[model samples]
Target chain A: MSAADDEIAPLPSGLEEARSAFVALCGGVGGAKLASGLQHHLQDRLSLIVNVGDDFDHLGLRICPDIDTVLYTLSSLNDQFRGWGRARETWNFMHALGQFGGDTWFQLGDLDLALHVVRTHRLGSGETLSAITADIAASLSIPARIIPATDDRLRTKVVTPGQTLDFQRYFVEQQCRPRVEALRFEGADRATVSTGAESSFADDTLAGIVICPSNPYLSVDPILAIPRLRQLLRDRSVPAVAVSPIIGGKAIKGPTTKIMQELGVACTAASIAKHYEGLVDGLIIDEADAEEAEGTSLPTLVTKTLMVDPRSRNELASRTLEFIQRLGGARRIGPQ
Target chain B: MSAADDEIAPLPSGLEEARSAFVALCGGVGGAKLASGLQHHLQDRLSLIVNVGDDFDHLGLRICPDIDTVLYTLSSLNDQFRGWGRARETWNFMHALGQFGGDTWFQLGDLDLALHVVRTHRLGSGETLSAITADIAASLSIPARIIPATDDRLRTKVVTPGQTLDFQRYFVEQQCRPRVEALRFEGADRATVSTGAESSFADDTLAGIVICPSNPYLSVDPILAIPRLRQLLRDRSVPAVAVSPIIGGKAIKGPTTKIMQELGVACTAASIAKHYEGLVDGLIIDEADAEEAEGTSLPTLVTKTLMVDPRSRNELASRTLEFIQRLGGARRIGPQ
Candidate 1:
């Protein structure tokens, strides 16, 4: 761990629930923030099953946006102000790339590009995405095990009215301005869960799952789209709780709310719960949405779901673990 | 063209010989500097036949070091202080790569890496090296046509007593410490000369060839090792002259002198002339090696060959062209 990570104050230190391994299904920025919170509390006991649906081949390099964000965020190397990529990054590579008429829309920071190059080289040599991510996480001193949902090629193709755009084309290059008609996980059926996540699912010490505050359709859906991974989630006896990405009828960052609105879904905590109705035992909403708690059919935990800072993220994580223990109804070892 | 290229005062402006198309067989650094001078004078009329033997696939990117050096040099983007790569280059990529436990021996500057990424991507998409190089040169606004000797894979392997090391592994990683027992071009036989070079050789306006002051055995020999390119050189009626890399019994840069000693050959202008033999008509020797003029069988031009600055490079190129004109023995258009 870095000197910076050592200085984080180690939140939720007294929470014994952290000893039992928990997995968070994550997307990019918003989800990565909560994943960082879980990582801090659980340390090595946490596993982040990051979405690979947004991963794409650009400039012959394998670029996994969500995985990289989680790696950077947990390692405390992320740009907090920008809410993405490594801090103190340079644009010299992009500037030079523009001089050669290369695609500049993705905005790959100089420090961020090194990760892409390493991942591309390793992937080209037949190394799995999960293995590479694990090594990179270790290199960045990220205590949590960051595994891809699947090692196989599973792309999320966004179906707009006129075109079927690649995930990055819709998300990054197009700035998500295109109204989403639908979304499809291209190779989801063939994709299988990584051994790391599979073993975590098939383990005795496994605790409840926490679906982080990421977009439901874009992030969580892709993982669940994989039949093998979905089967594992379905067969688990432990409770699976989800923190709502929606706060006060809006997403904190990104086009989550915009996408939801375009897809004809209401921008409310009840709608967020409805999206994950079958998959999750309960939904954790923000204090602003506490009024809507009785509106959902499933059980609910209303808290400050907006992780404005590290402290708020830790509080939400600790509360969510307590809620999951309540939902499971048996796996509790009380405070001595 | 950049404002920097325009700021460079044009040289040999009124010389009618500069109108005639001349091709320079070049390698890296030293040759690139002279090629820059030639480009300054000849512009669109100059063609650089760059050696591709030193090109290697490093970390999944096709890195053509010599070609990049020549392009940077001719485009006035080369670092004057470092004598290689782009000026104002950043090492952020290398720094970040080290964090991932990546290979750090071959230092890839952030600005320089953009070219490799572009080239590698294009190559993966089935684009030829010559075509991509031409596109990149055009993007850099370089008027001189920079042509790779071959589009095929041709690597220079250092055959030391202990092991056969890759050119970069020997040159950069080991810092050229190992004694050079021998050297071999891995795929020279199958490689064909680029169309840009073949067309230049076939052109009626072709004046002569200026073999730049790169290492004779390692650089120029690789081009000559290709049977077709050698036959074209042998068949050319125009005078082929060489600028001797050796001066005052020492090489200006690289392992030229050490390699000569290891191969049991003397480092002298006469020895350089002997190495070329029938491949070149005359040799351009530095004034420092004026005493060795009598020792060579071929006709020699004794001049200041140390290209300390841009002006020196221009002066040497101007002198070499003048010598080639004199060696050709007939065609002259002057005092227009």
Candidate 2:
């Protein structure tokens, strides 16, 4: 057993007869962390529906940051210290790109390019993004079912005060420098849930949904913006819990808090709860935000939610799963 | 003046008024060497119409081997010592490709990928190969018109005794081990010369056509196989001269002599002249094959053609241009 497995509670007694399958929604780095913990905790039974809002064609190759992050994280290839990409990755491609005066703003590592190349080729050959993502997961020996939110081109267009920007342009190229006004999922209205994702959530064996600590407006909201996907999630009878991305009025990573403040919302755990208020059955806030958890619209689980290490990640995942089990029982389901 | 200038006779009195413009046809490595010499010697007055038969899409990126070789060679970026690709290049991309279990037959350097990425993007955007190549040349400040023989998809498919293979699959992946039966230019029947290549050849100040020491049957032949391109060269009134790839019954680089021997042709300067019999007005052979030039079908220029260094390459290029000028005076146009 991994060090992470030691912290996770064993499958709840009656459910031990059959391993429970779960569907977790996630975005990039922050979401990948919690999704990784759940992957380690639940192993084969977990399905991670990653957001496709951040997907972009850079230098002619389709790059899916969130799905790639989940794949790299679960496969133990992610660079934790650098906060992105594969460990021990070389930046020769980027350096050489600079030599040619090609776009160097978006960093592409030599090792990272292999996945992009393969994905680009397969996509060019008419394979769907989700299929390519799953094949890559299988190639990396990642056991969990990693799914893209939708196969269609549902790009996140950040409508800042000055202009609209592609997700990568706003997040990476501009370093999230723009003031947020509103966000748009370019193709979300027409897009349906990816092939197996909706069914995975609707399955009889589905225990619950864990909306990981990804940015609500930028990350998780794009996936939910797909009308059918949102309707399907809303229609599901099982308990859906969200681990608050905000803790003590700050996001763990990325532009979540900044974007929230720009959108004129209070950058606190309570606002995060309110953001996903109608979708989730309960909210899991960090111990730092336990005081802010008062008078919440939904049932709350306050725990040590900062997943700094493998042990902490597992502990938080175990506590959240345990909380889900308790909520699946007597707690009245409120918002759909 | 360069050391090669010592052997190069001054431009004749009448021709000294205006520096002449020349159109040279070439392929990879060996061709690049001589093309570089002419580019240095002629500066802006040279047009290098590179063979496009070797172009292929690998890892979803359009790679024009001969055109890239020309670009890298003229820009002083080509890896002369290692044979192909850019200098001071890193193979981290290939290593990572190996890690992903990607195709490892054809080697792609990290620096090289930048060009491929940019080209692939441009090509996907509906721009022709010639346009992309010229644009890249401009980006690198390559002065000569680095034109592809044709922008159309005219691939060189090697027909070995066993089976037909793509140019790269035959040359790189298989290491040219397959015994040649015949080679096929897949789209030669319908392909036309690139937009500006024909006009460059037919210009008023056009001096001559120099066929560099690239493999005649493989590299140069594919360009000639393009019906319009061959007809255009045939229709040209100016002297068309060739430097024999063979010197002392051996090719300087690649499988020229081997393919010649396999194709049931004698590997001699005389045989090279015979191959280009109807097309070229003169043949330039090395000192080693001076005896083989005796009673050859075409006018022959015997010189020190072993271009082992910069001076020697320049010397050969200067000598060939002088031979073209000399041939332009005394020779009667025989083949059309």
The candidate that achieves the highest TM-score relative to the unseen native structure: 1
- Model 2 off-target regions past 4 Å? A1-17, A331-336, B1-17, B332-336
Best by lDDT: 1
lDDT of 2 at B39: 75
Q: What is the per-residue lDDT of model 2 for residues A1-336, given as tens digits with 9 covering 90 to 100?
A: 356557565545644455788899999888888887787768878999999999999888899998888888888889989989999898877876776667888899988998999889989999998888877788788899999999988999999876899989999989999898999999999997897787798778888889999999988999999998788778767778999988777998888888888889998877877888668889999888889778688889999888787777777777778778888875555342
Question: lDDT of each structure?
Answer: 0.87, 0.86
- What's model 1's interface RMSD, roughly to a tenth of an angstrom? 0.5
| Steric clash pairs (candidate 2) | none
**Which digits, one per residue and each the tens of the lDDT, describe model 1 over residues B157-243?**
999988999999999999999999999998998988888889988878888898999999888888888777888888877889999
For residue B21, model 2's alpha carbon misses the true position, in angstroms, by: 1.0
Model 2 lDDT tens row, B145-193: 8999888889999998868999899899888899999999999889989
Task: Judge candidate 2 at residue A92 and give its lDDT.
Answer: 77
Instruction: List residue ranges in candidate 1 displaced over 4 A.
Output: A1-18, A330-336, B1-18, B330-336
